[model samples]
Target: MLTEEGKKRRDALDAEITERIAAFKVEQRKMLEELAEIGIHVEMVNRLPNLPTSDYVQALPILIKHLRREYSEGTLASLARSLAAKDASEYWDELVAMYLASAHRISTGPGNLAMALAAAVAAACPKNRLDDLTNLVKNQRLPHRVLLLTPFKKRRGRDPAVARLIEELRHDPALAKEIGRWKILPSQASLRSH
Candidate 1:
């Protein structure tokens, strides 16, 4: 009952959707089974003096999965200690950064998720191994933190062009809109200040 062109187009569309669904399934399987692909190389996992093939970027997602797997207050610390027995410094920091970013991105209940991981690990494992992690917290800065101090605006040592841009930004719909959505709240007076 259909013309040749019409039937041909319908078949092509069906093929396209089938291709998309198959591709999606393959991608999902690959992601869910990433760590399994590493297999239990007894040498690497058992700490038998062998170099691990450099695959940190590839393995980072799997490592994150292990970290967020519902620790009993100090499970992560225990895990970090176990890992530290095999790996080197700041392993938990790097892993915890990935975990925190995931939790932050998910908008889940752990919103104020302090990297309270070191204490957990220190409790579960030999405490002496993680002094570096304790110090990393002192040195770490939250992402997207910035301080703008424009003393020249008040101290009489500024460019007119910069001043003009600052003034113009108030009226500029694009600039104002962009600034308005900043994560940090800007004071009304300071928003106007150059």
Candidate 2:
């Protein structure tokens, strides 16, 4: 099943894949070193492989500080998920700022930073920031804007403002389909397990 040219081509392809893998490993190591140099510590970087379940308190501040840095999308997604695993309410402003800044890039590719940031904001958003959250829902840049409504789902039964917001979103022609889809889907927390 192997002509000489086919064998050669296969070998060349294999070599290219191996080289790309090696380059990727080198880049990962350099990124880890840079994170360490910026006071992220080795343990925190190590915990990235586990994410959201591992203890992330020590690395939270450093991650937030570098939120706007030019790291890979996967790295940003991991950081956002880790923030969601705890009560990040104290860092609400910072998290929201990051979400707003990255809104344009969210939902565009495989490592969806928007979904992760939305989950973190849902976990961290305070009662007082409901208005701000509502505004985020209206941002057209975030194609997955419905994810921002998770907080309202949690509070709607107990808060009239949240209930009214949901009703308003349901009535909006632009948002009705997403709102309906969200209603049928499993909660975001459950989805995160996968």
Candidate 3:
């Protein structure tokens, strides 16, 4: 029923479709081989350490409840107290350190929360904010006199080192002016009464 020209065109189209299918299968097989070689390390990164239960919600509620307190000066005292404890202290030090260290490698895309915050908080280059923070700490440029005035809370939260810093701030007015920075207090009026 087909004319010669129509039959030729149909055969050409079919050949092209077959070639594309064959190419796709070859590519798919390579990807499968690569996956087999690598095994299952993809989901390992999202996991937190030392988790005790399958119910993560149940497991870390106490910790999260303590950390996400209502913002205020009095609350800062409590935050300081928590951060002063060994576990909380380590968390802040590590978290901040990690933030500062990774700022350089990440892209300033729609997905990067830590990078954006780090740049705003530290007044550093946006793309390299983490590097700047890390380098500052490393080179002793990390606001030696950091006041750490959070709107209501410290980013590092309850941690022992933060507690130590708070105690130091209580005695060190020089450091206070060097960094009138805060994690929660948006303005002087917001400093909690009591």
Candidate 4:
């Protein structure tokens, strides 16, 4: 029950989506390859947690602790990005806690794993949990003296939770100095182009 134009448009969109998925898988494979080169192996969970169980909640702290000891900061950051892509909402609180407890091991600069973790927190944590998330980052020295003030532009634009979190940081007196250190480049430009 579709018009000819509508059917054509739908087909085009499907093709585009398929291409995007293929590109993403390539990038993920590269990340996994790099992790392998460093001897950091991930035994992917058979099922990613969708509901927050007490056991799942408890496993996070232990996992983060073990990851920090076993991998370099760069490897840990890459792992965070890969996990965030899995849409693991149930683990946002644990991710924030992990960052707070071991942020010293995370390195800085754009595309930092901490930023990806923050994005997961932004996408998953409810509004009421925003303050807790913000406080954790603040207490952790805002993790490398810079934070992504806005979510990276995507097909859907910025996630609302991350936007709210960014707003919260904007008003914090303690973070005023650290926040000032971040420089955002226009999305169209790459570092090499600048």
| Best candidate, TM-score | 2
Model 3: per-residue Cα lDDT over 6-107, one tens digit each:
999999989986765454445334333433344421121112222322323222323223334332222222222322222333245433553455445433
Quote each prediction's TM-score: 0.23, 0.63, 0.22, 0.38
Best candidate, lDDT? 2
lDDT of each: 0.37, 0.66, 0.35, 0.47
Model 1 lDDT, residue 113, Cα: 27
Off by over 4 Å in 4: 1-69, 106-116, 137-140, 144-194
Residue-level lDDT tens digits of model 1 in 95-133 = 445434533332333112233333222222223433333
* Decoy 2 TM-score against native: 0.63
lDDT of 2 at 106: 38
Please identify which of the two predictions, 1 or 2, would achieve the higher TM-score against the true structure.
2
TM-score order of candidates, top first: 2, 4, 1, 3
Candidate 3 lDDT score at position 40: 20
Global Cα RMSD, each model: 17.9, 7.6, 18.1, 15.1
Runs in model 3 with CA error above 4 Å? Answer: 1-89, 106-108, 113-194
- The TM-score between candidate 4 and the true structure equals 0.38
How many clashes (backbone N, Cα, C below 3 Å) per candidate?
Answer: 1, 0, 21, 0
